[model samples]
Target: MMMQISIDPASNKHSLLNVMHRFIAAANNMDETIMVPSLLRDVPLEEQANNNNNNDDDDDVAETQVASNKQRDMYEHYLLLKSIKNDMEWGLLKREMSSGASFLEIAVKQEEEEQQQPSVKRDLAVEDNADLEHQFHYHLRGLFGVLSKLTLQADHLTNRYKREIGGGNFMR
Candidate 1:
C-alpha cells in the first residue's frame, strides 16, 4: 500500500513552504520542457526590455554596452535557477568572502559605524521582541514575493523555449 499526503489548499496557498514548493515545481517543469538547452542560448528574457528602458539616451547607450558585454544566455539562467533551488533546500554552502577586506577589518569598520550612530543603536536596543518578530515576518513576505516572481519567470522561459522550437501549443 502507498501513503498519500494532502494539503489544505486555502491555508497552504499563502504559506512560505507552498511558495518554495511552487518555485521548485516551476523550475522542474522548465528543466523538463527545455529539451535542447542550447536553443535558449543568446535568447533574451522577455523582461529584459523593461529593464533596458532609460530616459537618457547616453545612459541607455552606456548601460546597453555594459549589459551586452555581461548578458547571460537562457541556459545559464536555467542552471542558476536550479542551483538556487538546491541551495534553498540544502542551506547555502559557506565560502570565503570575496571582498579584499579581512574579517577583522570588516568587524572594525562595523564597530566604527555603530559608534558613529548612537541614536540608531539606541533605537535598535529599544526594539522589543515583538518588533523583531514583525521585522522577520516582513522580510519573509518579501522573500515569498520574490520566489513567486522567479517561479513565473521560469514558467515564462519554458513557454518561450517551446515556442522557439515549435514544440508545444504555447499561448501568450
Candidate 2:
C-alpha cells in the first residue's frame, strides 16, 4: 500500500521538523506503513494551513507514545514464537525419553524456572487447555531449577573441602 502523506511544510518549523523526523525513523525501522498516518494525524491540514497551532508539546508526546507501542509490539511478537518453539522442543524430549533420568530431570527443572521467573508476558497457553507439549514446558523448567541448585551446592561443598585439605576429591 502506498501511503501518500501530505504535510504542510509551510507550518511552524517544529511540526514540520517532527514530521520529517518520524518519516526518517519509519524508514530506518522498515516501518514505512506507520509513517503517513502518524505524521498526518499530528499535523492536520487545517492547522497546518492556519499557521496557528497550539499543540506543539502534544505532538512530541504522541510521537514518543507511538514509538513505545511499536517497540512493545515487536517484543511480543518475538516472545510468542520463542515460547512456542521452547514448548515444542520440551514436548519432544519428554515423548522420546520418558524412562530416562535425564529427560525426567529436565522436565522437572523447566517447570520450576517458569514458576520462579517474571517475564514480560505469561505463557499464552492456559494450563487447563494446554496439550502435552505445553505442559512439559512447565515441568521442564522446574526440573532444571532444582538440578542447577543442587549442582551449585555440591560444587561449593567440594571447593570448601579441597581448601581444607591438601588433596581432596569428591564424586558420588
Candidate 3:
C-alpha cells in the first residue's frame, strides 16, 4: 500500500523545529557532544555539592559525588534542549549539533578529569566494574522513554494532520 503526506517547504517554524528535533534525536541516542554536555550545562555546582556534601563520612561523600556527577552528565543534553525556547535558543542548538561526542570519548574525558582525585579514582574503579551493565540498562530505558515521547508526538501530528483532496498538500 502507498502512503502519502504533504509538507509545506517554506515553513520556517517547521525548519526550526526540525533543527531542534535533530539535537533531540542525538541526545535521545545518548551522543556525548550535543546531548551529554548540554545535560551538564545547567547543573548548578551548589546542588551537586550539596547532594553529596550532606554525608558526614568523607569516603561516602566522595563516592556519592562521583556517582551523582556521572548521573548529572548522562542526561545533561536533554535537560539543556528542554530548557531552550526562544531568543538565543538557535545559537545554542547550532553549537551543540555542530559538535558532540560519543559515550566512549565522554567517559575517557571524565576519567582524565577525575584522575587527579585519588578518592574519585577509587570510586571510578568501582564504577568501571559494572560500566557495561549500567550503560546497557541506561540506554535501554532511554530508548523506551524517547520512543514513547516520539510516538506520542507522532500520534498528535496524525490527529492534527488533515488530508487535502486533488493535491499532495496536507492541512494542519
The total number of steric clashes, by the backbone 3 Å criterion, in model 3 comes to 6
Local accuracy of candidate 1 as per-residue lDDT tens digits, 1-172: 9999887763578888888889999888988887777666665543346543522454343333334435676677777777777777765432213346676777788799999998978877787553888888899989987787678667766755765577432223
Q: Write the per-residue lDDT of candidate 2 for residues 1-172, one digit (tens) a residue.
A: 9999887664544443443333333233322222222222222112232322433554333333334334333224223333333444366665446556586688788788777763522554344456877677787666555333323322322222233233221121
TM-score for model 2?
0.22
Model 3 RMSD in angstroms? 19.8
Query: Candidate 1 vs candidate 3: which has greater TM-score?
Result: 1
Could you estimate the TM-score for every candidate?
0.57, 0.22, 0.28
Point out the higher-scoring one by lDDT: 1 or 3: 1
Clashes of each: 0, 19, 6
RMSD of each: 10.7, 26.2, 19.8
Worst 10 residues of 1 by lDDT: 90-99
Q: Runs in model 1 with CA error above 4 Å?
A: 1-11, 47-70, 94-130, 167-172
Error of 1 at 3 (Å): 25
In candidate 2, stretches whose alpha carbon ends up further than 4 angstroms from where it belongs are 1-130, 167-172
**Which scores better on TM-score, 2 or 3?**
3
Query: What stretches of model 3 exceed 4 Å from their correct place?
Result: 1-112, 161-172
